[model samples]
Target: MSAELPQPSTTSLADRVKNILIQPKDEWGRIDAEPATVAGIYKSYVVPLAAIGPVAGLIGMTVFGVRVFGLSYRPSFGATLSTAVAGYIAALIGVYVLAMILNALAPNFGGQKSEVQAMKVAAYSCTASWVAGIFQLIPALAWLAILGLYSLYLLWLGAPRLMRVPQDKAATYTIVTIVAAIVLFFLVGLVASSVTSMFMPRMPLPGGTLSVG
Candidate 1:
Protein backbone atom coordinates (compact mmCIF):
# COMPACT_ATOMS: atom_id res chain seq x y z
CA MET A 1 0.00 0.00 0.00
CA SER A 2 1.27 3.50 -0.79
CA ALA A 3 1.44 6.11 1.96
CA GLU A 4 -0.91 9.06 1.71
CA LEU A 5 0.58 12.49 1.06
CA PRO A 6 0.19 15.07 3.77
CA GLN A 7 -2.80 17.34 3.37
CA PRO A 8 -2.11 21.06 3.08
CA SER A 9 -2.90 23.04 6.21
CA THR A 10 -5.84 25.40 6.24
CA THR A 11 -5.79 28.84 7.82
CA SER A 12 -8.71 30.28 9.73
CA LEU A 13 -10.70 32.87 7.82
CA ALA A 14 -9.73 35.63 10.25
CA ASP A 15 -6.06 34.78 9.96
CA ARG A 16 -6.27 34.57 6.22
CA VAL A 17 -8.01 37.94 6.04
CA LYS A 18 -5.53 39.58 8.37
CA ASN A 19 -2.55 38.15 6.56
CA ILE A 20 -3.79 39.00 3.13
CA LEU A 21 -4.72 42.53 4.11
CA ILE A 22 -1.64 43.31 6.17
CA GLN A 23 1.05 41.49 4.26
CA PRO A 24 -0.31 40.57 0.88
CA LYS A 25 3.04 40.05 -0.78
CA ASP A 26 3.82 37.23 1.64
CA GLU A 27 0.26 35.95 1.76
CA TRP A 28 0.03 35.55 -2.01
CA GLY A 29 3.00 33.22 -1.88
CA ARG A 30 1.17 30.96 0.56
CA ILE A 31 -2.04 31.21 -1.42
CA ASP A 32 -0.20 30.19 -4.58
CA ALA A 33 1.00 26.96 -2.94
CA GLU A 34 -2.14 26.21 -0.93
CA PRO A 35 -4.22 23.34 -2.25
CA ALA A 36 -7.74 24.65 -2.68
CA THR A 37 -10.73 23.73 -4.83
CA VAL A 38 -12.82 26.41 -6.50
CA ALA A 39 -15.86 25.36 -4.48
CA GLY A 40 -13.85 25.38 -1.29
CA ILE A 41 -12.63 28.93 -1.96
CA TYR A 42 -16.13 30.16 -2.77
CA LYS A 43 -17.85 28.53 0.17
CA SER A 44 -15.22 29.33 2.77
CA TYR A 45 -14.03 32.77 1.68
CA VAL A 46 -15.95 34.39 -1.14
CA VAL A 47 -19.54 33.80 -0.01
CA PRO A 48 -19.15 35.19 3.49
CA LEU A 49 -16.92 38.16 2.67
CA ALA A 50 -18.97 39.16 -0.36
CA ALA A 51 -22.12 39.24 1.79
CA ILE A 52 -20.73 42.03 3.97
CA GLY A 53 -21.39 44.75 1.40
CA PRO A 54 -24.87 43.75 0.25
CA VAL A 55 -26.09 42.99 3.75
CA ALA A 56 -24.67 46.21 5.14
CA GLY A 57 -26.09 48.18 2.25
CA LEU A 58 -29.51 46.65 2.89
CA ILE A 59 -29.44 47.63 6.53
CA GLY A 60 -28.04 51.07 5.85
CA MET A 61 -30.56 51.98 3.18
CA THR A 62 -33.54 50.66 5.13
CA VAL A 63 -32.56 51.77 8.62
CA PHE A 64 -30.29 54.81 8.44
CA GLY A 65 -31.65 55.87 5.06
CA VAL A 66 -29.82 57.93 2.45
CA ARG A 67 -29.22 61.63 2.76
CA VAL A 68 -29.00 63.84 -0.28
CA PHE A 69 -29.12 67.64 -0.35
CA GLY A 70 -30.31 67.81 3.28
CA LEU A 71 -33.17 65.42 2.58
CA SER A 72 -33.35 61.84 3.81
CA TYR A 73 -35.02 59.02 1.89
CA ARG A 74 -35.51 55.41 2.87
CA PRO A 75 -36.12 52.73 0.29
CA SER A 76 -38.83 50.16 0.74
CA PHE A 77 -37.85 46.91 2.40
CA GLY A 78 -38.70 44.85 -0.70
CA ALA A 79 -36.67 47.08 -2.99
CA THR A 80 -33.70 47.14 -0.63
CA LEU A 81 -33.76 43.40 -0.15
CA SER A 82 -34.03 42.67 -3.85
CA THR A 83 -31.19 45.05 -4.66
CA ALA A 84 -29.01 43.50 -2.00
CA VAL A 85 -29.66 39.99 -3.26
CA ALA A 86 -29.02 40.99 -6.85
CA GLY A 87 -25.80 42.75 -5.95
CA TYR A 88 -24.62 39.76 -3.94
CA ILE A 89 -25.30 37.36 -6.79
CA ALA A 90 -23.56 39.71 -9.21
CA ALA A 91 -20.46 39.84 -7.00
CA LEU A 92 -20.22 36.05 -6.89
CA ILE A 93 -20.54 35.80 -10.64
CA GLY A 94 -18.03 38.65 -11.08
CA VAL A 95 -15.28 36.79 -9.27
CA TYR A 96 -15.68 33.68 -11.37
CA VAL A 97 -15.77 35.64 -14.58
CA LEU A 98 -12.69 37.61 -13.52
CA ALA A 99 -10.74 34.40 -12.95
CA MET A 100 -11.63 33.18 -16.43
CA ILE A 101 -10.49 36.45 -17.95
CA LEU A 102 -7.24 36.30 -16.03
CA ASN A 103 -6.52 32.79 -17.22
CA ALA A 104 -7.41 33.51 -20.80
CA LEU A 105 -5.18 36.58 -20.94
CA ALA A 106 -2.17 34.87 -19.41
CA PRO A 107 -0.60 33.83 -22.69
CA ASN A 108 -0.75 37.35 -24.05
CA PHE A 109 1.31 38.52 -21.10
CA GLY A 110 3.83 35.69 -21.30
CA GLY A 111 2.36 34.00 -18.26
CA GLN A 112 1.51 30.37 -17.56
CA LYS A 113 -2.21 29.64 -17.37
CA SER A 114 -3.53 27.82 -14.32
CA GLU A 115 -7.22 27.96 -13.57
CA VAL A 116 -6.73 27.33 -9.85
CA GLN A 117 -4.11 30.06 -9.53
CA ALA A 118 -6.25 32.48 -11.44
CA MET A 119 -9.13 31.76 -9.11
CA LYS A 120 -6.92 32.31 -6.10
CA VAL A 121 -5.80 35.65 -7.48
CA ALA A 122 -9.36 36.66 -8.22
CA ALA A 123 -10.75 35.78 -4.79
CA TYR A 124 -7.87 36.92 -2.59
CA SER A 125 -7.43 40.23 -4.36
CA CYS A 126 -10.96 41.23 -3.40
CA THR A 127 -10.26 40.98 0.32
CA ALA A 128 -9.79 44.73 0.73
CA SER A 129 -13.02 45.65 -1.04
CA TRP A 130 -15.05 43.06 0.86
CA VAL A 131 -13.73 44.14 4.24
CA ALA A 132 -14.38 47.77 3.42
CA GLY A 133 -18.04 46.83 3.08
CA ILE A 134 -18.35 47.43 6.81
CA PHE A 135 -18.44 51.13 6.00
CA GLN A 136 -21.77 50.57 4.31
CA LEU A 137 -23.39 49.99 7.71
CA ILE A 138 -23.64 53.74 8.18
CA PRO A 139 -25.06 55.64 5.24
CA ALA A 140 -23.04 58.71 6.14
CA LEU A 141 -19.82 56.73 6.08
CA ALA A 142 -20.62 54.86 2.89
CA TRP A 143 -18.19 56.99 0.92
CA LEU A 144 -15.39 55.32 2.87
CA ALA A 145 -16.11 52.17 0.94
CA ILE A 146 -14.07 53.70 -1.86
CA LEU A 147 -11.13 52.51 0.20
CA GLY A 148 -11.83 49.15 -1.40
CA LEU A 149 -9.94 50.40 -4.43
CA TYR A 150 -6.97 48.99 -2.57
CA SER A 151 -7.92 45.72 -4.20
CA LEU A 152 -6.49 47.01 -7.45
CA TYR A 153 -3.12 47.47 -5.83
CA LEU A 154 -3.36 44.01 -4.37
CA LEU A 155 -4.06 42.59 -7.81
CA TRP A 156 -1.14 44.45 -9.34
CA LEU A 157 1.14 42.86 -6.79
CA GLY A 158 -0.29 39.35 -6.92
CA ALA A 159 -0.89 38.81 -10.64
CA PRO A 160 2.69 38.59 -11.79
CA ARG A 161 3.59 36.37 -8.90
CA LEU A 162 0.76 33.88 -9.25
CA MET A 163 0.20 34.03 -13.00
CA ARG A 164 3.93 34.00 -13.83
CA VAL A 165 3.52 37.07 -16.04
CA PRO A 166 6.80 38.63 -17.07
CA GLN A 167 7.79 41.46 -14.72
CA ASP A 168 7.95 43.95 -17.55
CA LYS A 169 4.40 43.21 -18.62
CA ALA A 170 2.79 42.95 -15.17
CA ALA A 171 1.45 46.53 -15.20
CA THR A 172 -0.15 46.13 -18.61
CA TYR A 173 -1.68 42.81 -17.61
CA THR A 174 -3.16 44.24 -14.43
CA ILE A 175 -4.53 47.30 -16.25
CA VAL A 176 -6.19 45.25 -18.96
CA THR A 177 -7.67 42.89 -16.42
CA ILE A 178 -9.02 45.82 -14.36
CA VAL A 179 -10.59 47.44 -17.39
CA ALA A 180 -12.35 44.20 -18.25
CA ALA A 181 -13.60 43.77 -14.67
CA ILE A 182 -14.91 47.31 -14.56
CA VAL A 183 -16.91 46.79 -17.74
CA LEU A 184 -18.30 43.48 -16.47
CA PHE A 185 -19.42 44.92 -13.13
CA PHE A 186 -20.84 48.03 -14.77
CA LEU A 187 -23.10 45.91 -16.96
CA VAL A 188 -24.06 43.76 -13.99
CA GLY A 189 -24.95 46.87 -12.00
CA LEU A 190 -27.14 48.22 -14.79
CA VAL A 191 -29.06 44.96 -14.94
CA ALA A 192 -29.44 44.75 -11.15
CA SER A 193 -30.59 48.37 -10.96
CA SER A 194 -33.19 47.86 -13.68
CA VAL A 195 -34.59 44.79 -11.99
CA THR A 196 -34.62 46.31 -8.52
CA SER A 197 -36.25 49.55 -9.63
CA MET A 198 -39.51 47.74 -10.18
CA PHE A 199 -39.82 47.38 -6.42
CA MET A 200 -38.91 50.96 -5.54
CA PRO A 201 -41.52 53.21 -3.94
CA ARG A 202 -41.89 56.94 -4.40
CA MET A 203 -41.01 59.18 -1.49
CA PRO A 204 -42.46 62.63 -0.92
CA LEU A 205 -39.89 65.37 -0.37
CA PRO A 206 -40.15 69.10 0.37
CA GLY A 207 -39.84 70.35 -3.20
CA GLY A 208 -40.50 67.22 -5.24
CA THR A 209 -40.79 63.45 -5.18
CA LEU A 210 -37.93 60.95 -5.36
CA SER A 211 -37.65 57.22 -5.72
CA VAL A 212 -35.29 55.28 -3.53
CA GLY A 213 -34.22 51.80 -4.50
Candidate 2:
Protein backbone atom coordinates (compact mmCIF):
# COMPACT_ATOMS: atom_id res chain seq x y z
CA MET A 1 0.00 0.00 0.00
CA SER A 2 1.18 3.56 -0.67
CA ALA A 3 1.84 5.82 2.25
CA GLU A 4 -0.63 8.65 2.86
CA LEU A 5 0.66 12.17 2.36
CA PRO A 6 0.65 14.58 5.30
CA GLN A 7 -1.47 17.70 5.09
CA PRO A 8 0.11 21.05 5.80
CA SER A 9 -1.23 22.87 8.83
CA THR A 10 -3.86 25.09 7.34
CA THR A 11 -2.76 28.71 7.02
CA SER A 12 -3.80 31.12 9.74
CA LEU A 13 -7.31 32.38 9.05
CA ALA A 14 -6.29 35.96 9.77
CA ASP A 15 -3.39 35.99 7.30
CA ARG A 16 -5.43 34.24 4.67
CA VAL A 17 -8.30 36.67 5.17
CA LYS A 18 -6.02 39.69 5.17
CA ASN A 19 -4.03 38.78 2.09
CA ILE A 20 -7.07 37.70 0.09
CA LEU A 21 -8.84 40.97 0.84
CA ILE A 22 -5.83 43.32 0.74
CA GLN A 23 -3.65 41.77 -1.95
CA PRO A 24 -5.59 39.14 -3.88
CA LYS A 25 -3.35 39.44 -6.94
CA ASP A 26 -0.52 38.04 -4.86
CA GLU A 27 -2.53 35.79 -2.59
CA TRP A 28 -3.96 33.39 -5.17
CA GLY A 29 -0.57 31.81 -5.90
CA ARG A 30 0.22 31.57 -2.18
CA ILE A 31 -3.17 30.00 -1.56
CA ASP A 32 -2.73 27.55 -4.42
CA ALA A 33 0.65 26.58 -3.01
CA GLU A 34 -0.79 25.68 0.38
CA PRO A 35 -1.17 21.94 0.83
CA ALA A 36 -4.76 21.50 1.97
CA THR A 37 -7.63 19.10 1.53
CA VAL A 38 -11.17 20.07 0.75
CA ALA A 39 -12.29 19.06 4.24
CA GLY A 40 -9.53 21.11 5.83
CA ILE A 41 -10.44 24.09 3.72
CA TYR A 42 -14.07 23.88 4.84
CA LYS A 43 -13.23 23.34 8.48
CA SER A 44 -10.59 26.04 8.60
CA TYR A 45 -11.99 28.62 6.21
CA VAL A 46 -15.59 28.08 5.15
CA VAL A 47 -17.25 27.33 8.49
CA PRO A 48 -16.07 30.30 10.53
CA LEU A 49 -16.38 32.94 7.80
CA ALA A 50 -19.65 31.60 6.43
CA ALA A 51 -21.19 31.92 9.90
CA ILE A 52 -20.79 35.69 9.71
CA GLY A 53 -23.81 36.08 7.47
CA PRO A 54 -26.32 34.12 9.52
CA VAL A 55 -25.02 35.28 12.89
CA ALA A 56 -25.14 38.91 11.81
CA GLY A 57 -28.53 38.46 10.23
CA LEU A 58 -29.87 36.97 13.44
CA ILE A 59 -28.62 39.86 15.46
CA GLY A 60 -30.07 42.34 13.02
CA MET A 61 -33.52 40.87 12.54
CA THR A 62 -34.05 39.63 16.07
CA VAL A 63 -32.01 41.93 18.27
CA PHE A 64 -31.80 45.08 16.17
CA GLY A 65 -35.18 44.67 14.45
CA VAL A 66 -35.99 45.29 10.79
CA ARG A 67 -37.60 48.39 9.34
CA VAL A 68 -40.14 47.31 6.77
CA PHE A 69 -42.24 49.96 5.10
CA GLY A 70 -41.35 52.46 7.85
CA LEU A 71 -42.36 50.07 10.64
CA SER A 72 -40.04 48.20 12.95
CA TYR A 73 -40.63 44.51 13.64
CA ARG A 74 -38.48 41.77 15.01
CA PRO A 75 -38.45 38.17 13.96
CA SER A 76 -38.99 36.03 17.04
CA PHE A 77 -35.97 34.44 18.69
CA GLY A 78 -37.02 31.01 17.44
CA ALA A 79 -37.38 32.20 13.85
CA THR A 80 -34.06 33.95 14.01
CA LEU A 81 -32.36 30.89 15.44
CA SER A 82 -33.80 28.55 12.86
CA THR A 83 -32.98 30.87 10.00
CA ALA A 84 -29.43 31.31 11.22
CA VAL A 85 -28.88 27.56 11.40
CA ALA A 86 -30.35 27.00 7.98
CA GLY A 87 -28.42 29.87 6.46
CA TYR A 88 -25.12 28.62 7.88
CA ILE A 89 -25.63 25.14 6.47
CA ALA A 90 -26.73 26.59 3.17
CA ALA A 91 -23.65 28.73 2.93
CA LEU A 92 -21.36 25.78 3.57
CA ILE A 93 -23.06 23.58 1.01
CA GLY A 94 -23.16 26.41 -1.50
CA VAL A 95 -19.39 26.74 -1.42
CA TYR A 96 -18.90 23.05 -2.03
CA VAL A 97 -21.36 23.08 -4.91
CA LEU A 98 -19.76 26.09 -6.49
CA ALA A 99 -16.35 24.49 -6.17
CA MET A 100 -17.67 21.44 -7.95
CA ILE A 101 -19.20 23.56 -10.67
CA LEU A 102 -15.98 25.46 -11.17
CA ASN A 103 -13.96 22.31 -11.45
CA ALA A 104 -16.42 20.74 -13.85
CA LEU A 105 -16.55 23.75 -16.15
CA ALA A 106 -12.80 24.32 -16.21
CA PRO A 107 -12.27 22.48 -19.49
CA ASN A 108 -14.79 24.59 -21.35
CA PHE A 109 -13.08 27.72 -20.15
CA GLY A 110 -9.65 26.42 -21.20
CA GLY A 111 -8.64 26.25 -17.56
CA GLN A 112 -6.76 23.45 -15.87
CA LYS A 113 -9.00 21.32 -13.68
CA SER A 114 -8.27 20.46 -10.08
CA GLU A 115 -10.88 20.02 -7.38
CA VAL A 116 -8.65 21.29 -4.59
CA GLN A 117 -7.71 24.40 -6.56
CA ALA A 118 -11.34 25.09 -7.33
CA MET A 119 -12.23 24.83 -3.66
CA LYS A 120 -9.46 27.25 -2.77
CA VAL A 121 -10.66 29.69 -5.39
CA ALA A 122 -14.28 29.39 -4.36
CA ALA A 123 -13.70 29.68 -0.61
CA TYR A 124 -11.05 32.43 -0.52
CA SER A 125 -12.47 34.55 -3.29
CA CYS A 126 -15.63 34.62 -1.20
CA THR A 127 -13.84 36.24 1.75
CA ALA A 128 -15.05 39.73 0.90
CA SER A 129 -18.71 38.77 0.81
CA TRP A 130 -18.39 36.74 3.97
CA VAL A 131 -16.68 39.62 5.75
CA ALA A 132 -19.12 42.16 4.39
CA GLY A 133 -21.81 39.96 5.89
CA ILE A 134 -21.12 41.79 9.13
CA PHE A 135 -23.15 44.63 7.69
CA GLN A 136 -26.19 42.54 8.47
CA LEU A 137 -25.69 43.36 12.16
CA ILE A 138 -27.41 46.65 11.51
CA PRO A 139 -30.71 46.14 9.78
CA ALA A 140 -30.50 49.48 8.04
CA LEU A 141 -26.95 49.06 6.78
CA ALA A 142 -27.92 45.65 5.50
CA TRP A 143 -28.02 47.22 2.07
CA LEU A 144 -24.33 47.83 2.43
CA ALA A 145 -23.83 44.10 2.26
CA ILE A 146 -23.86 44.74 -1.45
CA LEU A 147 -20.25 45.59 -0.88
CA GLY A 148 -19.84 41.84 -1.03
CA LEU A 149 -19.91 42.32 -4.77
CA TYR A 150 -16.22 42.98 -4.41
CA SER A 151 -15.87 39.22 -4.31
CA LEU A 152 -16.76 39.14 -7.98
CA TYR A 153 -13.68 41.14 -8.80
CA LEU A 154 -11.62 38.92 -6.56
CA LEU A 155 -12.97 35.91 -8.44
CA TRP A 156 -12.13 37.44 -11.78
CA LEU A 157 -8.61 38.24 -10.70
CA GLY A 158 -7.95 34.84 -9.16
CA ALA A 159 -9.40 32.83 -12.02
CA PRO A 160 -6.33 33.19 -14.18
CA ARG A 161 -4.01 32.28 -11.36
CA LEU A 162 -5.91 29.50 -9.63
CA MET A 163 -7.71 27.88 -12.54
CA ARG A 164 -5.07 28.59 -15.14
CA VAL A 165 -7.59 30.13 -17.50
CA PRO A 166 -6.11 32.03 -20.40
CA GLN A 167 -6.32 35.76 -19.73
CA ASP A 168 -8.56 35.99 -22.78
CA LYS A 169 -11.06 33.50 -21.37
CA ALA A 170 -10.78 34.44 -17.70
CA ALA A 171 -13.48 37.07 -17.76
CA THR A 172 -15.98 34.78 -19.43
CA TYR A 173 -15.30 31.97 -16.98
CA THR A 174 -15.61 34.29 -13.98
CA ILE A 175 -18.84 35.79 -15.28
CA VAL A 176 -20.41 32.37 -15.79
CA THR A 177 -19.34 31.25 -12.33
CA ILE A 178 -20.81 34.43 -10.91
CA VAL A 179 -24.16 33.93 -12.57
CA ALA A 180 -24.31 30.40 -11.22
CA ALA A 181 -23.35 31.66 -7.76
CA ILE A 182 -26.19 34.17 -7.84
CA VAL A 183 -28.68 31.46 -8.67
CA LEU A 184 -27.32 29.31 -5.87
CA PHE A 185 -27.62 32.18 -3.42
CA PHE A 186 -31.22 32.74 -4.43
CA LEU A 187 -32.09 29.08 -4.03
CA VAL A 188 -30.44 28.88 -0.62
CA GLY A 189 -32.18 32.07 0.49
CA LEU A 190 -35.55 30.76 -0.65
CA VAL A 191 -35.05 27.53 1.25
CA ALA A 192 -33.89 29.28 4.41
CA SER A 193 -36.82 31.69 4.21
CA SER A 194 -39.25 28.85 3.76
CA VAL A 195 -37.79 27.01 6.72
CA THR A 196 -37.91 30.17 8.81
CA SER A 197 -41.51 30.88 7.91
CA MET A 198 -42.52 27.35 8.80
CA PHE A 199 -41.21 27.80 12.33
CA MET A 200 -42.28 31.43 12.71
CA PRO A 201 -45.48 32.35 14.43
CA ARG A 202 -47.61 35.18 13.11
CA MET A 203 -45.83 38.31 14.29
CA PRO A 204 -47.86 41.19 15.57
CA LEU A 205 -47.06 44.58 14.07
CA PRO A 206 -47.80 47.85 15.79
CA GLY A 207 -51.38 49.22 15.87
CA GLY A 208 -53.16 45.87 16.14
CA THR A 209 -51.68 44.53 12.93
CA LEU A 210 -50.86 40.83 12.51
CA SER A 211 -48.29 40.04 9.86
CA VAL A 212 -48.07 36.49 8.49
CA GLY A 213 -44.34 36.64 8.15
* TM-score for predicted model 1 compared with the true structure: 0.87
TM-score of each: 0.87, 0.87
lDDT of 2: 0.82
What C-alpha RMSD separates each model from the true structure?
Answer: 3.9, 3.5
> Please, what are the lDDT tens digits per residue for candidate 2 over residues 133-199?
9999987888898999888888778766788888888888888988888887789779887887675
Per-residue C-alpha lDDT of model 1 across residues 1-213, encoded as one tens digit per residue: 996653443899999999999999999999888887777888889999999999999998877766777666776676788889988998899889989999999899999998878988999998998999889899899889889988888888888789999999988998999888778768877877776666553444343235444
Top model number, lDDT: 1
**Candidate 1 C-alpha RMSD relative to the actual structure:** 3.9
Q: Which parts of model 2 are misplaced by more than 4 Å?
A: 1-6, 199-213
